[model samples]
Target: MSIAIIGPAEIEAMIDREVADYPTDTRAGAQTLEAFQNARRKPRLVSVNFSGGITQKCYSVTRPNGDYRVIYLPLAGYFSLCVESDFGPLDIGVHGPAIACFGSV
Candidate 1:
């Protein structure tokens, strides 16, 4: 099945809000924002997984702080965010589609 990314505007806006926590004038913050923008422009497809005949595509963006994974569940038309940190992967939350996708998945 072909994988499609959903809600680019919402995704970009959310990422922008998250990045806004850092002061724009700070070097680290600026670098982080730049990395995020670059990733949004050309996200790297990290993997494709199939479970119960359902396919999911994972795309990742490298940031100064951590890596962000955008997982697309095409069947459900849902997208979820996973952030990598020193501790481990944290589920930022699900975006796009609706909460019904969560129950079904």
Candidate 2:
């Protein structure tokens, strides 16, 4: 699998437009980012990953700079994010919560 990366300019723009008001101390920013990743990392059966939903594909991930799972979604791209380090059980959330739908290539 190809490694995912965000260019410095892109990350800089995100920081500027998204967290620009924050203080110079990166501790707060890091904390905020960590919290978000922890909140999003929920293990679930993901097969045909939708644009923004869970699947049963069962991914294999290995990245230490940060543990991440690369999912190929219906949007025709991958979303790689840091693994969830939360101490509690995971809860999966899907856009179509009632019917249990799925899609593929």
Best by lDDT: 1
TM-score (C-alpha, index-matched) for candidate 2: 0.21
Cα deviation at 79, candidate 2, in Å, is 3.5
How accurate locally is residue 61 in candidate 1, as Cα lDDT from 0 to 100?
36
Residue range 1-105, candidate 1, lDDT tens digits: 774545545544544565556456978657655554554543344444342443344444332234554544334455555556554334455555221212122
Clashing pairs in 1: none
Against the true structure, what is each candidate's TM-score?
0.33, 0.21
Clashing pairs in model 2, backbone N/Cα/C closer than 3 A: 45-55, 45-56, 46-55, 46-56, 46-57, 47-55, 47-56, 47-57
Taking every candidate in turn, the Cα RMSD to the unseen true structure, in Å, is 9.4, 12.5
Per-residue lDDT of candidate 2, residues 68-105 (tens digit) = 33232223222333233342111222222111111100
Of candidate 1, the 10-residue stretch with the lowest lDDT total is: 96-105
Cα miss at 105, model 2 (Å)?
Answer: 30
User: Which candidate wins on TM-score?
Assistant: 1
**Per-residue lDDT of 31 in model 1:** 65
